[model samples]
Target: MPSLNKILLFLSSALATAISVLVLGFSMSIQWVETTMDCTSSGSSFSNGSAVVTLSLFDGTMTRIHCPFFGGQDDFEVFPQLAGIGGTPLVLHGLVVCVLVLCLLFSACSILISLYNSVSNPYETYMGPIGVYVCSSLSASFSVVVLLIFAVNVNNV
Candidate 1:
């Protein structure tokens, strides 16, 4: 039964890690859409779009979470003043890259630890489950941070 427990633990940990990645990736993609989508015209009005976007989060039926930053009044308008011409700030892209790197790091670490535990139990101490739980939690926490940052960026937009 311990072996079964270990397998279950590993599987659930894997699932959780996958979920975390999915959540972060989805949020990132949503941000990208907001950054690139044409929102200046031919869409809902600013106030209506903002309200709908905010409500989308609670709808529970939509897979995509829209934000006011995308097409509403905010529209994440950015410009690179130092570059002479106008464009999105380099710092914005840098932040997104940083978040992606962190997510990848945590996901890779979780998978690696799980694989190592399954392959070699040198001490037979059964640290696999404990390790898995910790890794999963860490990844989940990082995911939350990504989500919060997304919200912040949206508002700034």
Candidate 2:
């Protein structure tokens, strides 16, 4: 029984670690960009001349260098602005899916282990000190990671 708990703990910890590393890798590639119209003018012939708009990466709320124009018409030939990661959205979505799957797997395993221990070893004597410690620690740690990841996803959205 104790060995079973240890197995559950090992699995949960390994899964959580894998998920955190993966999320951090994906987040590393993410960047936020912001574009602001510095200036604009209306040409005499109804053809308005707008100042060259620049898009720059946001560095802690501060705009960085100018981003190259993506090319688009914005009511007046305004360049298509950029304000997100260079990587495709599909790539980011895949990474997110991987992280969520890992989280769900760990959460389910933890819950199942806890339930099994409660029913099979209700006497409390059956669970050795090490086994109890490992089980509880793993469940708590993975729960915390889940919460953190959820918060990160919410903020990203």
Candidate 3:
């Protein structure tokens, strides 16, 4: 029978795998930033309704996030197209996604190592007790980075 330590490792690794999968799945639903800007007509009696735009994690299709700055444009009513998303904010979004993928890879490695350990004693110097800790730490560190990046992007960018 497998020792209690091995069983615990296997269970923890399984939980980590589940959490990793969830993190990746959540990334698919991108949140968009929204803004509305009112347009002014020089010859009209009143102001036209504001344009409502939801700009979120830009995939390079839109020039930039919709801001109130567009109200200054005299001919905004003529063209309905918004600017393509760009700049450092886009870079951070990509960074979050890449780090998450790395986290998932490390978590998978941890799961495999622990599962092997449950069957038989993994070599102490190579893939058992030490390996589990290393992989778990790496996965956890990457997770922290991903969270920090996402938080900063949402708050500052």
Candidate 4:
């Protein structure tokens, strides 16, 4: 049987990988939306209208739809200024994703190593547990930071 420590380490690593994947999915989705009012050019008889605007972080695009109760629908696309406004957040998010992938890979390796150690030399000491702890912690921290950045930046947008 594998040691209790090894079993715990494997579970922790698996949990970390699952959490990282979940956060990555959220970070890649459209994160913000806003509505605004617009007026028509009918002189004194101007009509009120509303527009729905959405910002997608992964695609770096702003989509707008003019949905007026009295007129035909109009769609507008504003090219995302990736380097202008979203540069910092995008870079941070990308870095977090890379770290998460690395952590997942490391965790898988650790699990394999643990299994090997258990079967081949059940009495010997191995570094798999230490690696699992380190990778899990690092990935969790990165995920939290990425979430905070997303929340703040999305709110601002």
Candidate 5:
């Protein structure tokens, strides 16, 4: 017997949570780093070996290096780099993760509040929608900033 507004609110919050989870997962993936270099010879017109380096965050930071032509496969530790001057990307990543966590937490609270508001007495005061709006905006802004920082830093690298 919930109102249409309440139903929409619940659905929207759920959708936001799902989308945030997806974005966070994608962001944390190492696929973010992909580079190609040309080293062809003048007469042979052949392409040199190319390597793809990926950085992923799990129990610990990991870097995967793969070069099919050279038959080179190796993994390198990257945590030390985070302490160096080029650690801007890692710092930005941490910020993104923190913001996403906040977004998910607030959205979940919004969902629960909406459910309660729908089922409870009409006289009750509801603040869940406000929290949802604020959190959503904050999440969006932080996400954009993270993307920009990552893109610029990666390009520079």
Candidate 6:
């Protein structure tokens, strides 16, 4: 039978790996940020409707949901504004995605190391407890990086 420590390591690593995958999926598919504004009461004759902006953090894309924005009758005019945003917020969003990717990778490493170490002769060095701890800590560190970058991106955007 496997040792209690081995079993615990295997279970914790497995759970971390699964959670990482689900979070990555959500990051890619779900809308990360959204803002809606009512321009009708802006004391301007031309501004008559609301505007909505949605952001996809994973891809650094900003989408304008409302057409003919600011009471402009031509819908295609706003198309140019829908292009990928540039500058600090864009860089910040990219950083968030990259950190999350790193987090997922480290989580996978931890799970593999746990399985291998538990099943075989656990190495006294990196392949043993050291490997699992390093991978888990790196994963956690990347998660914190992602949060900080995302917060900066949202604030700047």
lDDT of 6 by residue, 1-157 (tens): 6677777777677676667768766776776666675555445567545666565543323333343433332223222332346667556666776788888888888878777666664343237777778888898888878877777767876
> What digit string (tens of lDDT, one per residue) describes model 2 on residues 34-83?
33433223343442223333221112222222323333333311111112
Displacement of residue 121 (Cα, Å) in model 2 is 3.5
Q: What is the lDDT of candidate 4?
A: 0.53
lDDT per residue (tens digit) for residues 4-68 in model 1: 56656666666777777777666654423222332333465553222222211111111222543
Compare the candidates by lDDT and give the number of the best one.
Answer: 6
Candidate 4 structure quality by residue, lDDT tens digits, 82-128: 34566565565456456556645654555555455544444564565
Which residue pairs show backbone clashes in model 6? none
Task: Give lDDT for model 6.
Answer: 0.65
- Which is superior by TM-score, 1 or 4? 4
Per-model tally of clashing residue pairs: 0, 1, 9, 0, 0, 0
lDDT of 5 at 123: 49
lDDT measured at residue 78 in model 6 versus the true structure, 0 to 100? 20
lDDT of 3 by residue, 1-157 (tens): 6677767877677677667667655664454444454545667756555665443333312222233344322222101222134566567777977887788788788777777776665333237667878887898898789778977875654
Among the numbered candidates, top TM-score falls to 6
lDDT (CA) for every model shown? 0.51, 0.42, 0.61, 0.53, 0.57, 0.65
The TM-score of candidate 6 is: 0.68
Candidate 5 Cα outliers beyond 4 Å, as residue runs: 1-5, 37-48, 57-70, 82-118
The list of candidate 4 runs beyond 4 A from truth reads 1-48, 54-57, 60-63, 67-80, 84-120
TM-score of each: 0.51, 0.30, 0.56, 0.52, 0.61, 0.68
As for TM-score, the candidate ahead, 3 or 4, is 3
